[model samples]
Target: MDKANQSQQVTELTLAGLTDDPRLKGPLFVLFLLVYFITLAGNLGMVALIRSSSQLQSPMYFFLGNLSLLDACYASVVAPRTLMNLLMEKKTISLVGCAAQLFFFIGFGSTECFLLAAMAYDRYVAICNPLLYQSIMSHRVCVLLVAGSYVLGLLHSLVHTEFAFSLPFCPPAEIDDFYCEIMPVLAVSCSNTQVNRHLILGLGGLVEMVTILAVLVSYSFILSAVSKISSFKGRHKAFSTCTSHLTGVTIFHGSILALNFRPRPTDTLSTDKTFAVFYSLVVPMLNPLIYSFRNREVKSALREFVVWK
Candidate 1:
């Protein structure tokens, strides 16, 4: 198509949300609203507890606090619009709005990946080299790690968003998923998307693989270190330190792998949407609960704060 004709294509795209059955909308809205509320309360509460409790001041909780903040952010990027879409007669987002959504979603998602790897490294140092843990994961080092995650996330988002949005969207620009995800957006494009697909597969796969490898290697070393503790009690104590993080990692990475790493047959859009819901919404709600409920230190800090108040 010529430039003039391409420019005349639909600028506002319609979203085919989670369901088309009108009867499902009310129930789905209530369900998602409840989930969103819990996500907000849980993440915000965790951040507040970490900030206020001096006893919880450590490299681990520092990262946990940031994880909570990111969870809230990542959830906010999609959940509100999803909630509105469930209620609205027409689920539409302009091209610019869609681009912004894709940017922030990818940015925060990538940041979380790096942050999880950083947290894994922190755990490795604490468990494997206790004596040098303090020096190695110093405040400055932690800050730099966190900052680097955000910077990399921003760059990743910028590249993907620019590439995805630069393509000409054809008429009948209806996205198959609930949100403006890279794959769904690309599927609706008039321009050839082989490059975009390769970029998504290559870059996205690279990030996921590297981060996951880091976590796996760190945990392998951690297991080895824990096994060296001859006493059952000592081994248990060591394992307890990583349980919460391991759980969070499992849920987050499991959902992401299901979404991105799997083969994308056209028939699997519904399955993809289901995984997206888990990754984008349910995972955020679960993170705070996983960390706070599973960790003795976090529980103790909460109890102490309550008693003091």
Candidate 2:
């Protein structure tokens, strides 16, 4: 078979994207701009709030501040480009631009995965070993965990980005979705992708699964400990501390697992796109809101800021 036939047999990918209708461009651009602003403001506000608040100087809040920073960095990598593409006629990303996007996106994303796991462990110590919470979640330990998350993210991103770019882009370098992603890029590769697919499934899948398992195990112990607490107020406080993290975890993992693990041939591209939005856009925006709006401390701090204003 010829190259064209081979390409068709592999996949009929619309790398530039599905919609080029001028009529839809204006509305889409406005909508994406709104999303970008919200994502940026929400994540940055959370970071600032954590830094400025004396009551939030604890280890848990420290981790949360780091998480907020990660979310902001994660969203910045892809959302601006997506917003611009929605506004412009041509939605082309240069090779170097795409590589940078992939690097930061993967770095922040991987960091977040580990950071969430670290947060879960923090909760585990707080609940399961309340007497030792301070010692276990000491300032030094918290700093190490936060630094580890970023370092791991950087290393993992380096591996994936280097491997991804190793493949030559002979022609037709188009990413189907709004941003640079592994699956879409793999599909566009003219060379054999069996090794790449296997590595992605093994390494990427393992990292996600391990982090999720760690969270689940930590939460299980936390729930057991929570059940033993006799005071209603105590129980409520304990549960509230974790509710935001749990909600964010559910959204992030559920959306990503559903998108990636489903039967590829059976699922539509539209389905993937919707799920991508949840991870790449909505989750970052929601992280701050879910964690901060629901917390009394955060609300009180915001109120004080408003009063001062």
Candidate 3:
């Protein structure tokens, strides 16, 4: 069939998963299966802990719970299919299914970017304006922020997903990546993909720039506020509150920005796949640990819960 006919008839695309090495499949599956479960346990446990604990009755913990929820969903969007494909000889997903996956994946990702900014702003309020922090970062206001993040994330994902599948993909029509992110799907298109490419990059860059700026500006103010503290203990306490959030921000944004703004696609498949896995799988699993180990309140809460049990 011709390209046009094939595009009309094609309902699915084969996924070229992480590796084709038969020797590595079993090991990879076991590794990622462990990763996925740990992610779920950690993230979900954080959410529950935050919700159930009275000690965590603050804007920061509220945002942390939401962040944990997003991480769980974010990891879930990619991990199951990746595990399944690891065992399958011919890994395939329907075009509609691919769109759905990309929609949720990007939805969680974009929401996370804005949510991180909100989190930074929350810290700024807590540190820089402690007197008004409770009033400024009220429950109603935090709920509004989270709801706004979801709305914006879903809308952005909608536009990207709509534009993506609109293209009449070329023959073979197989996606080279594990998931249906914009760039990978675009690589298989029969039509001029320059516009879509630019659109995705432009939109993604715009969102990242805005969020990164918010985080940076918030931190700058926080630094200024911290500098006024006379006591070493006061300065240390102020800095301690920010360490976990800053660590998370650095890891999440550093990986994403590096991968997104890479000079060009590398010759090897592993680079792209590695980035995809790191952000999706590893980050989620690591976040709970980052918060648990770094934050005193979380550790205390965990201990209390353990003692109560």
Best by lDDT: 1
Candidates sorted by TM-score, best first = 3, 1, 2
Quote the positional error of residue 247 for candidate 2 in Å.
Answer: 0.6
lDDT of 1 by residue, 28-132 (tens): 999999999999999999999999998888998899999999999999999999999999989999999999999999999999999999999999999999999
Residue 130's lDDT within candidate 3 is 92
Model 2, range 1-309, lDDT digits (tens) per residue?
A: 365455544322234653678887788777777888998898898889888878788898999998988898888887887877777666777667777888888888888989999999998998888899998899999999999988987898898888887665644556778888888887777778788788878877887999999999999999999999999999998888898889988988787787777678777887788788778888888899898777888888888877877
Segments of candidate 3 deviating more than 4 angstroms: 265-267
lDDT of 1: 0.92
Assess every candidate by TM-score.
0.96, 0.92, 0.97
CA error at residue 279 for candidate 2, angstroms: 1.5
Distance (Å) between predicted and true CA of 206, model 2? 0.8
The true-structure Cα RMSD of candidate 1 reads: 1.5
Judged by TM-score, which candidate is best?
Answer: 3
Q: Write the per-residue lDDT of candidate 3 for residues 2-98, one digit (tens) a residue.
A: 8888778777888999889999999999999999999999999999999988999899999999999999999999999999999999999998899
lDDT of candidate 3 vs native?
0.90
Off by over 4 Å in 2: 1-15
Global lDDT scores for all candidate models: 0.92, 0.82, 0.90
lDDT value for model 2: 0.82
